[model samples]
Target: MHSAIDAATLRAYRDTHYRVRGDTPMTLRIDQPSPALAALHQVHGVDCSAFITAANPHSRRCGDDANARRQLALAQDLERMGLAAMAAAGEHPSNGWPAEPSFLVPGLSLHDARMLGEKYGQNAVVWSGADAVPRLVLLR
Candidate 1:
């Protein structure tokens, strides 16, 4: 259950607001059960989802262009996999970090979510099961 990510960064991930964008935007908090997410899951006919991003790999800040490119690649990869994705952002409540473009991928399994996290060099991903309780899944 351990990862190479540092404690501060791990704490930051837990504190991040994983915002799912739309006309009625929803901010998903770690370890919190979201009614909005439960409704979203009902819409998608899914029992689970994941909040993933392709920015600041391994907790290292990168240029906007690089982050954008990585984000685009992740979108493409998800498209190729035939998965559903909603535009989202990883925003720190205190503005300690820049809001990173992210995705709320409905129906993405926990295993696949972890794989995508590893693929994009993320330290962790926010995942929710049938109960809609998002947990931080750490990756090295």
Candidate 2:
């Protein structure tokens, strides 16, 4: 079964686990969600929504080649959704300088973020907090 997470919990988690950064107005990444998560979105009237992830942007684990592959994969996913997305190599707010660039999407509301997390089976959802801090919500 799915569960809910409050804002305070999310905010604390982000502060403790990730390197939070200021909002990057023009950049974001949409990671591919699992099949169950995709199905949950459809049921919730989110016909097309991208699953965002929080990761250290400065990590070199993936390298240049892997980064390109991820971009290509995300492009394909967006295409399937019939949505236009742009990919760029830049420093993202939450992730830093990711090996793979992230797809730029509009900022979402807290409500939307929660819904996305609930459906995506995410352990948590991270977004820019009111004071510009990175906030998170643990999902179980």
- Number of the top lDDT candidate: 1
Question: What C-alpha lDDT values do all the predictions have?
Answer: 0.91, 0.40
TM-scores for every candidate against the unseen true structure: 0.96, 0.36
lDDT of 1 by residue, 1-140 (tens): 67788888888888888998975489999998899999989988999999999999998899899999999999999999999789999999995788999999999999999999999999889999999999999887
- For model 2, residues 37-131, the per-residue Cα lDDT tens digits are 33433444443333243222222255666556655655664566565443333333453334324443223445655654454334655444223
Clashes of 1: 0
Q: How close to the true structure is residue 45 of candidate 1, measured as C-alpha lDDT?
A: 97
The alpha-carbon deviation from the true structure for residue 7 of candidate 1, after best TM-score superposition, in angstroms, is: 1.2
Flag regions of model 1 displaced more than 4 Å.
none
Find the candidate with the highest TM-score and give its number. 1
Clashing pairs in 1: none
Give candidate 2's error at residue 63 in angstroms.
1.2
